[model samples]
Target: MNQNLVIALAQVNPTVGDIDGNLARARAVRAEAAAAGADLVVGGELLVAGYPPEDLVLKPAFIDRVEAAVEAFARETADGGPAFLLGAPWQMRGRLFNAALLLDGGRIAAVTRKYDLPNYGVFDEKRVFAAGPLPEPIPFRDARLGVLICEDMWTAAATAALAERGADLLLVLNGSPFEFDKPDVRLDLARARAAESGRPLAYVNLVGGQDELVFDGDSFVIDASGAVMARLESWDERMAVTRWRARDGVWVCEPAAVAARPVGEEAIFAALVTGLRDYVDKNGFPGIVLGMSGGIDSALSAAVAVDALGADRVRLVAMPSPYTSRASVEDAAETARLLGAKLESVSIEPAMQAFGHMLAGLFAGRPADETEENIQARARAVTLMALSNKFGHMLLTTGNKSEMSVGYATLYGDMCGGYSVLKDVYKTTVFALARWRNRERPAGALGPGGRVIPERVITKPPSAELKPNQTDQDTLPPYDELDAILRGLVEDERSIAEMTAGGFDETTVRRVWRMLHRAEYKRRQAPPGVKITHRAFGRDRRYPLTNRFTDLA
Candidate 1:
C-alpha cells in the first residue's frame, strides 16, 4: 500500500455521441498522467460517451459501443503504471445506469453508479438513467477512493456515507454546465462536503460546449480543512494533477498550482466565447457572418465573434435601411475596422421598397405601423441569409436577452441566424461587457486589445431604428428598469406585485409581464444561443407558449 498517492484530473472536453474520439482522448490523457507519476487518473462524468448523451443512451447499440470503449480503455492500463477512473453509461439487468468504471492493472477493477439523478434545469437524468443505491468507497491501490457523480456530490449524504465507510479520499466527476457564479457555488458545496466528511475532495468537471450548454472546466481539489489546494482553468481544457499524502491518519492534498478563476462579466464573456466557438467549430461552419447594426448589441456580438473565431473568420455586414442613420453606418464601419473584421455595406432599401410595393394595395387603408417596420427587418434577414448560403458562413443573430424577453425583436427578421451570441445577455449587461472587453482582453481572446468597441456605441441610446426617431425605450421600458423587472419575472419568477413593491412601477411591470408571455412563441423558434446568466431562454427557463396564466397583480 502506497502511503502517498498522486491523482490527475483529466479535464477533457467530450462531444456527445463521439465514443471513439472520447475514448482516444481519455487514453491520451491517461498516458500523460502516467508520465507525470500519477498513481490514478479520473475523468469527468460520462467521459467515454460524453455528458448528457440525451436520448442516445436509450438505444441499446449506443450503450454497447460505450461499454466497449470503456473496456478498450481498461485494456490500455495493462502497462500497470497508473489506474484510470472514468464515467460511462452501463446497462445492468436491463436497467440503464450512469456508472463510473475503475480500471487498474489492465482490467476493469470495480464500477460505481450515480445515486442522485438531477432532473431539473437542463438535466433530465431521471428520464434517461436509473438512480443506483448509495455508492460506497472503491479500493484503488492502497487507498479506498470514494467516487460520486455530478449530482450526488451536491448533497451531503453521499460524501458522509463514504466517510463513514472509511473512504480515504473523495473524487467527484461532473458534467456541470457553466452559469454565472456557478464556480463559487460548486466550491462552496465541495467545501461543505469536505468539512463534513473530514476528507480531501477532488472535483473534475467537463469542459466544452454541447448544444446550448457550455461546460466550463473549473476542476479543483480541496483539503480536509476546506482550503483550495489546486484549481484548474475555467472555460478551457486542461489536465490538472494533485498530490495527496496521509498525514496523522488523515489524507490531505498538498498545495499545488491554483489558477485564478474569472469572475463576473469576465466569466460570462468567456462562456459566450467558448460556447460560440464550439457551436460553430463542432457543427462544421466555415466561419460566421453577422449584421453589424453599430448598436451596442451587434457591436458586442461582433467583438465576441472576432474573439471566438478570429477577425478573418468573422464577416460584418452593415445593412442600412431608409431609417438607418448615417451615424449608425459610420459607427458600424468603425467597429469593423477596430475589430479587423471585413465589413460589407448592403442596403436594405431596395428590398424594403419591393415589399412595400408588393403590399401597398393590401395595406392601402391601414396606417403604416410595426408591419412596415418588420418588412425592413425581414429584408435585412433575407440579405444576410443569402450571404450565409452563398459563402457557407453561419449567420450570427445579435439580439440581447432584454429584447428577447419582451417580444421586442422581429421573428424571422433580426432573429434569423444559426446562433445568437447575446441571446441570454441583458441590454444593460451588454453595455457592461462591451466596456469590460474594451479595457481587458481576457485569456483566449484572439481580437486586438484596447478599446475595440467604440465608446460612442456604449453611450448611445438603443434602438431598432425601424421608424423615424425610433428607440427601444419608445416601445419598452428603459433597459435598467426593464432588465430589473425581467430578472424578477423571468429569473426570480416573481409576481408583478412583488416587483412593483420593490420600487418598480405597477404599470411597467404588468406591461413587461404581458410582453414576456407573448414572446414565448418567438423564443421557441429562435436559434440557440450561449447561456451566461443563471436562467437562459431555452433550457434553463421553459415557459408554455399557450399559457394564459399571468402573475400580474
Candidate 2:
C-alpha cells in the first residue's frame, strides 16, 4: 500500500510580542485540525513570536521566551495528535535565524531556517536575523516535507534544492502582507514553484493586521501540474485539511473546494477593516473616536470603524467651525444615524474666536491667509484630542493618501490620531471604496448592510471647510488626475520626464513631485494605516525629509 497523509493548513491572527497568547491560539487550532484526523498541521511564518518580530528579536529575553515556549510546545506533541510545524525566531550557536521547527514525538525533530531574508519594501529581516544556508527536506510520517519560509518561495533556488534532495511536497509558511494585486502574485509564485519542482505544494499564511500591514489569509494548495486544489478565505481565520496520497513516487493533494475570495475594492475595504480592527483590539483600546467632517474620507473612516469595532465602540465628533456648511453638518448627522454610532457636536468657533482675538495684535497689518485657515484645523485637532483623552477612545485620522501626498493636510491638525484607515488609500480609491461599501456589505462586517455613508457625502465636492467657497480642487488638481500623477511618482517611481511623457502636464507633474517630497516629514508623523497599495507611505516607502534632487523634465 502507498503512503497517505493528511495535512492541515491553519491560518491564525497573531498579535506581535504576545508569546503565550500566540501559542494558545496555535494549540487551539491544532486541536481542531486533530479532530479532523490530520497527520500534520502547518502554520504561517513566525507563529510563535509573530512574523516580522522586528526589533523584538533583538532582545535576548524575547528570544528566551520564544525558545522556551517552542520547547514546551514541542513537548505537547506527546498527546499523539497532529504534529505541528511552526515558525519562530530561533537562536542557535549564538546567532538568531528566522526558523521553522518540526515538532513530532514530543521533541523538536528538525529545524528549517529561512535562507531568503526579504530586505526590501516592508521587510527588513536582513537587519535582524542572519540568513541561513539552503534548507533540506524534513522526514515526516510517510512523506518528506520540503519547507520554505515566506521569502524562500519567491525564487526557484530553494524549491529546486528541495526537489533534488527527493522531497515529495513543497510546504510554505508566509507572513505575506495584502497588496491590492498580491493574491494573484502569490498564487503565480506557488504555481511556478510547483511546475519547476514537479511536486505538489501547500501554502499557509498568517491572517490579521500587524501595525500598518494586514495579511490576507488566502492560503492555498497546488498540485504537481501547477493547478490549485484547495483555497482558503481571506481576511479571516480559517483551517482546512487536505488529503494527500502517494502516486507514481510523488505526493498529490486531493482536490478540495476553493472558497471565493474578495478582490479589488472589496478586498481593499476588507483590508482596511481588518487592519483597523486588529490595531485597536490588539492595542487594548476600548473604542475609536474620530472627527467626522461629512467629507468622504471621514465618512468612510467612520463607516470602517463601525464595521470593524461595532457602532457602540465608535464615537463620532463633529467639529464645526464658522466655515463649515449647513450641508456638511446635516450630512454628518445623517451619517451617524445610518451607522447607529454615537455622535457629538463641538463647534470650533469659540476656539477660533479666541485664537483670532489673541493673534489680532500680531496680525494687525497682516491680511487673513492660510495661517487663519490652519488655525481652524488646529482647533479641530484640539477638540478631537480632548474628546479622545477624556473618553478612552483612540483617535482615528481620516485623511486620504491624495491629500497626504500633496501636503494638503495639516501636520498636527487633521493628522493627529492614533491610527488611520485611509492613510494608504488615495482620494479616488477612497471614493470607490465608499460607493462599494454602500452597496455591498463585506464578509464579516459588523455594520449595517446598506448605505452607511450618505449619498450627498459621496457626490459632494471635497473640502477642508476652513474657508468660504473653498474646495479641494481650489488648492489641488482633481482627485482623478492627482491620483494618476501621484501613482506614477509614488508607486511606479517614475521620473518627472516619464510622467510628462505619459501625457501628464510637465508643470503639474513637477509640482506634484515637489509636494510628494515635501510631505515626507508629514507622512513620517502620520498615523499608521492599512497598506492596500504596493507603495504605502510608512515602512513600505522611505524618503529623506530634506532632499535637493527634483527630477525636473
Candidate 3:
C-alpha cells in the first residue's frame, strides 16, 4: 500500500429526517473516498438519522428505519474497498444503544456503544438511549483504532480505556455545534488527549444546521506529539485524505497543509451564513421573507440572508408605521437595494389608524401605553403574514438574543416569523457584525459584491425607531454592559453574588436577574434560532418558569 495507510474524513451536511437523501450523500462520499484510494473513511456521529434527533430517536418506527438504513449501508460497503465507520442507533436486546457501526468488506466489523451521553447543555442523549458498555479498540491493517462517539471522547474513562487497551490512534465522530472559539476548545481537547495517551488523534465533525443547532465543520488530525497535521476548512463540506506511516513502529500521520482560520467578526459572520444557508436548503424551503427595518439587526439579517440564499430568493418588505422614521425608511430601502432582493414598501400607517379608530371607544381616556404599541406591532404582523401567505415564502424574524432575553420584543409583532436569523446573536454582536460587514467583505458573500450594509447603518445610534426619537438604551441597558452580564450569568453560570462581587452594580445585577427570569415565557414562545453556545434557549437551557430559585443561590 505504498508504505502508508490512507484515511479519509468526510464532513458533509445532512438533513435531520431526510433518510434517503442523507444515505445517498453518505454513499457518494464513501465512493469519493474509495476513489481517493483511502483505506479507511469515517462519517460524523449519527450518520443514519442525523444528530440531535431528539424525540425522533424515541419512536420505535424511526429506530427501525435507522436500523434498516444502517444495515443497507453496511451491505453497500461490501464492495470490499475501504473500511467505513459511521454512527447510528443500535436496537439490541429490547434496549436502544447509541452506537458506532464499523463496516469492512460488506460485513459488520464492530458495533461500539457510547458510554457518555451528555445530559446537560444542548444535549439530551441521556433521555433518548441507554449508555453502552465501554468501547474496545478494533485492529485493522497494522494499526489499532479506537472509535468514540460525540460525548464519549469528552469523558476520561472512555479515552482511558482506549489508552489502556493498546490502541494506536484515537478517532472521534461528532455533531458538535458552533460557538465562538469552539474549534479552539476542541483542538485543545484533542491536543491534551494526544499528549496524555501518546497517540495520534483524528476528529471528524458534522457540518450543517438542524433546527437551532449549527454544526461547524473544522475537522482536523493531530500527531502523537499533539501537533495538528491536517485541518478541514470551517463551515464547509470538506473531504480530507491523509496517510499514516508506521515509522519505527510508531504510527505517524502526515497530512497536507491547509489555509489559516478566520478571525473574530469574520469567523462569526461566516458561521451565521453557513448555518442559515444549510438550514434553508436542507429543509427544502422555497425561499425566505422578512420585514425590512432600518435597524442594524434587520440590516445585518438581510445581508446574511442575501449571502445565504441568493438575493432573488430573499424577499424584503419595508412595512412602515407612524412610528417609523424617514431615515429608517430610506435605510431599509437602501439595504434592500444593496442586497439586490425584491423590495415592497407597505405602509402600516393606514392599518394602524384603522385599528386605533376601531378601538377608540374601548381605549377611551386610557391614553397612550404599551398596549397601543403592541396593537401597532400586531397590525404589522397581520400585514406580514398576509404577504407571506400570498407569496409562499418562509418568514424570517430579526430579533437578536439581547432583545429576546429582555422580552423587549412584542410576541405577535417582531416575533411572528417562521425562522429567526439573529435570535442567538447578542445586540453587541449585532453592532459589531454590522460594522464589520459594512467595512469588510465576509467570507462566502453572495450579494451584489461590495459591502452589503452602508456605513451610516453601523455609525448611527442603535434604535428600534418604533416611536419618534426612540433609542434601545431608553428601555434597555447599554449593549456592552448587558452582554457582559449575560455572559457571566448565562454562559459562565455565575451567581448573582459573584456577579456583584465582580464589579457589577448590586441593584443592577438583581434587577437584570429578575428580568432574565421573567422573560422565560417570551423565550419559550419565540421561534427557534441558531444556537452558537453549549447553552441556548428552548432546547439546551431549560430553566423552570415557575421556579422560585434565584441567582442569589
Candidate 4:
C-alpha cells in the first residue's frame, strides 16, 4: 500500500525577541497538528524571532537566543510524530541567511536559505540577508518537498531550481502584508508557481497587525494542476489539516476551503478595528478613551472601539469651545448615546480664555491666525489626556489619512494619543466606512437603536471646529478630488506629470505633492495606524526625515 501524508499549515503570528513565547506557539500548533495525525506543519518567515526583526538579528545574543529556542523545539519533538518546516534567520560561518529549516526526530533535517532578497517598496531584505545557493527538496515518505522562504517564491528561479533538483511538492512560508485585492493576486501567483514547479504547493502566512502593517494569514494550497484546493481566513487565527494521497506513485492533494475574507469597507473596517483592539490589549492598556467631535473620523473611531471592546470599555469626551457649533455638540452627544457610551462635556472655554490672555503679550505683534485655532485643539487634547491620566484609559487619537498626510492636524493637540486608530484610512474612506459601519452593525456594536453616525455628519461639510465658520474644504480640496490625486501618487506611484496627464490640474497636483512631502516629518511622529494598503506611511512609505523635494509640473 502507498503511504499517504496529511500536512498542517500553521499560520502563526509570532512576536519578535520573544523567543520562548514564539517557541511555545510553535509547540502548541505542532501538538495540535500531531494530534490530528498530520505528518508535517509549515510556519511563516522569521517564526522564531518574528518577521522584520530588523536589526535585532545583528545582535549575537539575539541569534543565540533564537538558536537555543530552536534547539528546545527540536527536543520537544524528539519522537517526531510530525515534521516541522518553518522560516528563521540562521547564522553560519559568521553570516546570516534567511533560512527554512526542517525539524524531525529531535534534529535539523535540512535547512534551505533564501536566494532572492526583495529590495523594492517596503522590503529591505537584501540589506539584512546574504543570498544563498539553490536548494534541493527534502525527500520524505512518498513526496519530495522543497522549502522556500518568502522572497524566493516571488521569483521563478527558485521554483525552477527546485524543479531541476527533482522536487515533487513545494511549500512556502510567507509574512505577506495586506493590501486591497492582494488575496486574489497571491492565489494567482501560487497557482502559477505550483504549475511551474510541477508539484502541489502549500502556503502559510503569519496573521495580525504589526505597527502599521497587518499580515492577513489566508494561507492556502494549490494542486499540481495549479488549481487552489484549500484556503484560510484572512486577518484571523485559524488552523486546518489537509490530506495528501499517493496516487500512482505521485503525491496528490485534497484540501478544505477557507471561509472567504471580508471585502472592501468591511475588510478594511475589521482590520482597523482589530488593529486598535489588539494594540491596546497587547500593550496592557486598561481601556480606550477618545474625544467625540461629531466628525466622521472620531465617530468611526468610537464605533470601532465599542466594537473592539465592550461599549463599557470605550469612553468619549466632548470638550467643546466657542468655535464648536451647537449642531456639532448635539450630533456628538447623540452619536455617543447611540454607542451606549456615557459622554462627558468639559468646556475648554475657560482654559482657552486663560491661555489666550496669557499669550496676548507674546502674540502682540502677530495677527490672530491658526495659533488661535490650534489653541482650541490643544485645549481639547489637554482635557482628553487629563481624563486619560486620571482614569488610566489609553487615548485613541482620531485623524484620518488625508489630514495626516498634509499637516492639517495639530501636532501635540490632536496627535495626543497612546495609539492612532485611523492613521492609515483616508478621509474619503472614513466617510464611506462611517456610512457602511452605520448601515451594517458589528456583532458587538454598543448602539441600541439606529446608525450611530448621523446622516447630518455624513452629509455635512467636514470641519475642524477650531475656528468660527471653518470647514475642511476651506483649507483643503474636496475629499474625492484629493483622494484621486493621492491614490494615483501614493498608491500607484504616479509622478507629477502622470497626475497632470490623468486630468488633474497641474497646479493642484504640485501643491498636493508639496503638502505630502512637507508633512513627512509629521507623519513620522504620528502614532501608528492599521495598514490596509500595501504601502502604509510607516513601514512601507519611507522618506528622509529632512528633505525638500517639490514637483513643479
Alpha-carbon local distance difference test for all models:
0.90, 0.92, 0.83, 0.83
Q: What tens-digit string does per-residue lDDT give for candidate 3 at 1-553?
A: 3346899998978887767778888888888999999999888988778877888888898888887877788887778778888888788899888888888877788888988888877788888899998889998888888888978777768888899998888999998888877878888888887888888989999987888788888888999787789888877788889888886657888867664777688878887887788778876777888888887888899999998888988988888887788888888888888878888888888887888899999889887877878877777788888877888778889999888877889998889888887888888899888877777766667866677787677778887666778888888788899988988877787899899989998887887788888899888889878877666677777777788876554
Predicted candidate 2 versus true structure: per-residue lDDT over 17-119, tens digit per residue = 9999999999999999999999999999998998768999999999999999999999999889999998999998999999999998899999999999999
Clashes of each: 0, 0, 1, 0
Ranking by lDDT: 2, 1, 4, 3
Task: Assess every candidate by TM-score.
Answer: 0.98, 0.99, 0.96, 0.94
Model 4, stretches more than 4 Å misplaced?
Answer: 442-450, 545-548
lDDT of 1 by residue, 394-481 (tens): 9999998999999999999999999998999999899999999999997979999888988889998888899989888888888998
lDDT of 1: 0.90
Worst 10 residues of 2 by lDDT: 544-553
Candidate 3 structure, TM-score to reference: 0.96
Q: Write the per-residue lDDT of candidate 4 for residues 155-230, one digit (tens) a residue.
A: 8899999888888788898988777678788878887888887788888999876666668788988888877788
Indicate which candidate wins on lDDT: 2
Candidates in descending TM-score order: 2, 1, 3, 4
When 1 and 2 are scored with lDDT, the better candidate is 2
Candidate 3 runs further than 4 Å off: 1-3, 550-553
Error of 4 at 186 (Å): 1.2
Which candidate should be chosen as best, given TM-score against the real structure? Answer: 2
